[model samples]
Target chain A: MSGALLADAPGVLAALAQGASAVLLGLGLLFWFAGSWPLLGRASYLTKLHYLGISDTLGSALMLLGLLLRFQREWPLLVLALLSLVVWNTIFGYVLAACSQPRRRP
Target chain B: MSRLIVIALRMLIWLLLSADPELLNVAIGLAVSLALPLPRRVRALSPGQFWRALGESVTALPQAYSQAARLLLHRRLEESVVHDEPARVGGRASSVLVFLDVFRITLTPFTIALGLEGGGRRYRVHELVFEEKER
Candidate 1:
């Protein structure tokens, strides 16, 4: 019994990791869908942009994190990608919000 | 002092990206880090402020997630303009606080800042659900 448990330990750990990765990926997809659905409604451009940008950023980050867990050897690249996503996404969202604002009259 | 820190951080990132600890890679990273122009005013958060922001974010995450989930599950979309009351914090600190608020709110799927209004003192935020009391 002890031998069997020892033999299955690695397999169990691997399966656990795989399951976690899949769950993360699924949650990411769900966020994407949730964020996108509101865009088809009567919300204004700014509202739509909000949902799309925030959800997309979170979803992408979650997906990258999932991949990072599944592929530990490529952590360097994955970490870089995740950092880029956070910084770039925020900057991009700021730019979009700024551009959408009304200009002040002289 | 901040410039040196920035350069060191860049070099570290360069090393990570290169994934090689060879002398040549290190030298290249050093050179690149030195070549990059540092910001004129590098803002460094105090440890206290950093901890506050971290704690605030930890507390806000669940609220944001539930808000998003509620919005999505109900398919309810509402638009209302809200302003952030003026904060007592001044100058760069206030700006940093505003940025932190924006970042925290946007991290959730429910709320997004449209723009800074009232000369950057107030943020015009669009929420997934509109609250009449705030309007």
Candidate 2:
């Protein structure tokens, strides 16, 4: 095969990976922006929960995924563990917040 | 000799956790030396007191270790919530627990920003509040 043919496969793969990373980055950015907007107004307790929960979990997950993709390592097991820990940490925050709050009567 | 052993062990643990081992060793050694417990005859303390202290510390150690590990590993709180009740205290942020020993207060990432030992005791903390109410 000619040199041009040899390079085409890798170039297309790189472009595809870049496109995927951009999408992931944009999604994470959107989550973060939406979650933080409530700080400007009189934010309620529920609002605060919404802000922290979505941003903390989904945004962080997306960000971590993007980072892993960028690294493009073959260590699948390590990556899975890292992602799980990040998600767990995010959920744990929500749990702590919930436990700290006083229960309301029906 | 026995007293010296106890002091030395305590110093070792402090050193392991501390950033400046030399400074902590000096400080702890000085404090222990200055505040050495009275002789067994002079103090006439009951043996039960020693056992009680040992038991309490033994129970507290695992908890302190887990809390410290969580801090080091960046483990987030499992549950945290904010509810506005009739303000028993004036400000939203009031009543900080310092040196409570409940959750390994010493080695936590949050350090006491300011403390006042007036009527009782008061502390101001500068911690990264993952969640806090604005008002």
Candidate 3:
């Protein structure tokens, strides 16, 4: 068994990586569904936004990690996407929350 | 100056997107970064302040994940309250620092920074806590 595995070590490693990436992708999708399901509920807007943050930023980041693992040669681009997506979406959520507030007289 | 840091950030992003270190590519990246107009005047930002804020933002990523898990697993949410926390670096903080602060706060599932209120002395955070706390 050891000799058989040694002959195709690279192939085995690649298969394992592919399987792991698939799991990560599925998990990220699960996060998206779980987070978004609250939007239809009676929860307040800010609470909904919190759920959105988890789905949009963290879930997407997880998906990006999956892609990064599967496509090692394209790591730089994947990394750029991951960073911008996380920062921009998180900030966007804040903007939405801030705008929802009533203005105070200066 | 904070502007220098902003330019460096742009250049870093450009390099990451292009994935090329050729001389001409570097030159073009620098030129574009300079060409882009920065928002109304950046204030002086010390290196220590910049790094500390950046470090906090990085650490927030893991914390954000944990909070996301907590939020997802809990079937009921008790309430969300808007409250103020004394600012760590208050009073006209650099925009970069402000951005990092906002990013760190809003990245987590349990909290969102509503913006600095009460004359920028504190951050007005909207938070959700399901479990009761013993006072």
Candidate 4:
């Protein structure tokens, strides 16, 4: 049974490979924390945004790409759909915010 | 029929990525099971509102698709700067939800989220570059 499961595994190994990068990212974050990176400790708002935004987006996207690659055969549509939904949600959120906001007179 | 198909496909994708098919089924069943009974508070004057909302969603599919495609074609615009004048406050929190909603907005390419505070109000915004209209 275990062997059969392994044989049917779509991107099981790829998932594991992606997991490795997750570990790398986690480690980098740890190093930054341990070194008390000035940005992490008390950086200005925009600076902090730069750090967290880059890390969060790249880390998440890399992890998703790995998973998608692994699961490509069995669930290609699902992967695309999930990615589309995430993108759409972000777009909708921006649109909603923009619509609700007022422009300044300058 | 199309609506059901869309819902089912969405459910399947969610289930697969979540890596838990049974949980997905259970959640869906639970949602359907619970949705039939309206709590007293939400028992609206007319049920037409629900159908109206559904119709709106059905009609919006084409627009959503176009928007999605347009967005995909471009590199994400991540940050924008907004210069906001001060805001005045009424009670301790009339604008609280509005403030929270604005700050919560984030984008893809270069949009910077600004948390606003002023005379009495709060806002969150991103600045975008658009050309001024002539005349």
lDDT on C-alpha atoms for all candidate structures: 0.69, 0.44, 0.89, 0.43
Tens-digit per-residue lDDT, B1-135, candidate 1: 446656876987897798888999899899989988867776655656655765775576566666666656654444546445443243355444566666666666556665556555556665555442132
TM-score per prediction, in order, is 0.78, 0.37, 0.91, 0.33
Q: List, residue by residue over A2-105, the lDDT tens digit for candidate 2.
A: 78877798887777787787787786777666655654666544435445544554555566666656667533543554445543644354445445445533
TM-score-best of 2 and 4: 2
Model 3 lDDT vs. the true structure?
0.89
Question: Against the true structure, whose DockQ is highest?
Answer: 3
Pairs of residues clashing in candidate 3: none
lDDT of 4 by residue, B64-88 (tens): 3333233323423344356653333
* Docking quality level of the chain pair in candidate 1: medium
Rank order by lDDT, top first? Answer: 3, 1, 2, 4
DockQ, cand. 1:
0.51
Q: Give me the iRMSD of candidate 1, please.
A: 2.9
Which is the leading candidate under TM-score?
Answer: 3
lDDT score for residue B101 of model 3: 90
lDDT of 2 by residue, B94-130 (tens): 1222212212222222221222223223322223333
Model 3 Cα shift for residue B71 (angstroms): 0.6
Over the stretch A1-106, how does candidate 3's per-residue lDDT look in tens digits?
Answer: 9999899999999998899899889889989999999998989999999999988999999999999889989999999999889989999999999999988554
Would you list the rank order by DockQ, best first? 3, 1, 4, 2
